[model samples]
Target: MKRAAKYIIGVMSGTSLDGIDIAYVKFNQTAANDFQILNAITIPYGKEWKSALKEGFHLSGEKLVKLDADYGIYLGKTILKFIKENNIEKVDLIASHGHTIFHNPTENYTFQIGNGPQITAITNIKTICNFRVQDVALGGQGAPLVPVGDELLFSEYDYCLNLGGFSNISFKENNQRIAFDICPVNIVLNHYVAALNLEYDNKGAMASEGNIEINLLNKLNSLSFYDEAKPKSLGYEFVSETIFPIIDKFNLSINDILRTFVEHIALQISKKIESNSEKTMLVTGGGAFNTFLMERLQSHTKTPLIIPDENIINFKEALVFALLGFLKDEGKINCLKSVTGASKDHSSGVVYEVESSKFPFSR
Candidate 1:
């Protein structure tokens, strides 16, 4: 089964509702760390699709199941279009990080939509997904799975922090890699920006234009989650039940809310950095694009945040999930117990294969 390289499609849709990220990658079959993103894209979710996923948080029973299958089909067809448009001639596998619908590891349950079998059936390529459940089953937090990627590929940096829907960081501490969510970032910021009938706060301009409310800032800084130990994560439930209510009671304008929250995010993240000998903090994900937020973050810490090229910032998680899927296919451990608190380091993901193509175009 050896080959010079493995061509994989890594797909990711975070809780931020940013979009589905597609990364066509090539990996050295013998050296896992050697990789390249041959092509990548972020397919913005249409209005109807976005609204459906937003409402899916409250769905249950058959409604939830239907959304899962529908999303899988959507992903499958989307990948096919990407392949055609790029004139991609070879694809051995697809590694999809399905959108997180619910992630409450304490309750021993976490679900990501986009069924793997449906993807395999539609695309006729081996598909690997459902990456978090096994770790949760092992009494782990089932979160910050990207740390495995950090340990394997980006170990040169002292810290690998991702500011996606929720902000999470990974770094080597003592001898083991440690990681956990710091606070809400784009997820909280985007929610309030929607109030202004906009998709985002371009360059964080609105946040920079307003004032930070001292009272709101203090309350956000004092949330219990900030003081919690490592191996933690945040979900939409935390925002809907905890963050939004706190911000709404103050009844501040979206500008002020964004301003205060931006400061709060910066402060929480600053608290995590200890002036270390190795000072490079690699920042990635959609939040890295927020100019004002980055400025605020710089003011809070001296660790020197390093934001890589746009491709890495936008699609690192998708790239990592691609690595995770590849590791599983290779029968190597992709989930780390140190980062996830799992029972043991293990490869986690369900792989699906198909014998024939039902897709419109044949390979």
Candidate 2:
């Protein structure tokens, strides 16, 4: 069977609550790792929605269920509006990495709210989502799902590091993809900056202006998470419980806190890559735009950090989620056992269909 091009709308909302990124991408089987981004936009969350989502992690049972469905509806409506605004008439599928509410793979359960059924009903389009549950059920860390994309699409780079809500790195070693969350990035950074009434420290200027608190930096560097082995991840729970309390005890100014944390991040990340023979590291995600952070990172390691243009930096995860969904659609291996510590490599994600749509690639 000859398959035509796959036009997938990839939607993602990271833990940082930065925004909802929706990318209209076209994938061609014949082109091999080639995909075209026809249209893409990031819709920032309003204050109310942002607060609601931030607090969603604490919601229980019925309230949590309601939040899941409501968030799904929100995502669907947002996707529809994006299509309308972009005049996008053709779409094959919608692949959404819904917002993570609870991610404790140690307990063998992870939840990313935004119900797939609601999305299909609202959009009248086939959708793929809930990508992590199955992997966790298989006794895996159920994270760093982007490694499959890094392997299949961006294999040229020696390392693929994403500086989003969390700093996670992916690379190949011994013919297997190795990846894990290095440290908290925008999630921690944005939380402190919010106190200053700014969404983010512009180009790390505030950090550059302040002196690094050595005691705070040393304590941060000695966190248990850094000493743990790979196949691990971080979540909002860890940040709120472990990180916030520790940082608060110092009573340092925001700039000092930011400066010390940035150094901590750079050190933690550099430690992982310092011994590697591979020298080219492709850096993406929101943190890559932080000039001060990048400078500190570069100073820590001699490895050449390659930052692509704004599009790749901002939307790579959304782009990779699209590829993951595409792999699931094709019944191919979308999750790696080595990277995620899963029992086996498997195609992950729940596929939902809208009856009798005009999708030429319908399975």
Candidate 3:
């Protein structure tokens, strides 16, 4: 017999490479989609790990495979540490959104490192990971997977927008879920700010101080990605190839570049959330902490923005990934064809379970 209520650990390493987010979530099927975040923490990547991941994408296939396994062991060790430090022993599953290395759906391939077997072997917890590969296999973008959680867990709001490495929004459209990436956020901002030896612009202060380069902002806003239809996503490759070269050509001050790009991000996001009138947009992720960016976004639309507690703002993705795992465990449609343009709605994830595993919790 299977249990309805589960204690699961969700682990995520995003494109921003900020750190690994681990959330211990208790999902109760009181009626479906009811859950609580019991504990969550982000372990900032050390200098070595950060450097390795930053360069891992460019490695040869042979080297990339090795790096993938190594990263998996690293994630396993980190998850173990998180569980030990928090005294979390009872867990049904571990869902890891291993760091995304390459994501290009047009080529019909996407890869996220950190081996699932390595995680299960090291942590002794059943694991579900590599959630995107299946979606891509079905001729979809294999991204913006958070919408399934948004549809069930956060449907009260008109929009569920996450401003992480990239800005993505999910909402119900004509009784179907629709979601897609809007633009780059921390992925671009952090790249420029690294020149100043800062991890990020505190509350977008640096961007607030600088003047917007109108030319640059206009160019960025005019990028073809904004005009494309839904069921789309962005990756590090797009940024490194498309975004950086354009900005570098201008040779503007770092401050100006930051300010213009922030403006560009706000403009692009406003285009999506401000369309429907009087809607409540739930904003989360690192970008939500950027005061200047938030102010700019608010100014662009009359729609009210609802930002939850810091926990939700920071670790909501991890929490939602846990929900995705729960859906997969129940053999439900966790990845929507409508949201991802896949061939069909399907449960997307590879599960690894220990032999005759005893679930620590009793329902």
**TM-score of each model, paired residue for residue:** 0.96, 0.96, 0.96
All candidates in order of lDDT, best leading: 2, 3, 1
Residues 80-117 of candidate 1: C-alpha lDDT, one tens digit per residue? 89999999999989999899899999899999999998
After superposition on all C-alphas, the RMSD of every candidate to the true structure, in Å, is: 3.5, 3.2, 3.8
Model 3 clash count equals 0
Report the C-alpha lDDT of model 2 over 1-363, residue by residue, as the tens digit: 666999999999999898899889999887558888888889999998899899998899999999999999999999988988888888989999999999999988999999998999999989999999999999998898998889988899999999999999999889889999999999999999999789999899999988889988888888888889889988888999999999999999998989989999999999998544457999999999999999999998888999998888889999999998888998999999999999999999999998774777848
C-alpha RMSD of candidate 3: 3.8
Which stretches in model 3 have alpha-carbon errors above 4 Å?
1-4, 275-277, 356-363
* Residue 28 displacement in candidate 1 (angstroms): 1.5
Clashing pairs in 3: none
Worst-scoring 10-residue span by lDDT in model 3? 270-279
Error of 1 at 345 (Å): 0.9
Task: Give a tens-digit lDDT track for model 3, residues 4-62.
Answer: 67999988898888999999999878855678899999999898998999998799778
Displacement of residue 343 (Cα, Å) in model 3 is 1.0
Per-model lDDT: 0.91, 0.91, 0.91
lDDT, candidate 1, at 127 = 97
Question: What TM-score, to 2 decimals, does candidate 2 have?
Answer: 0.96
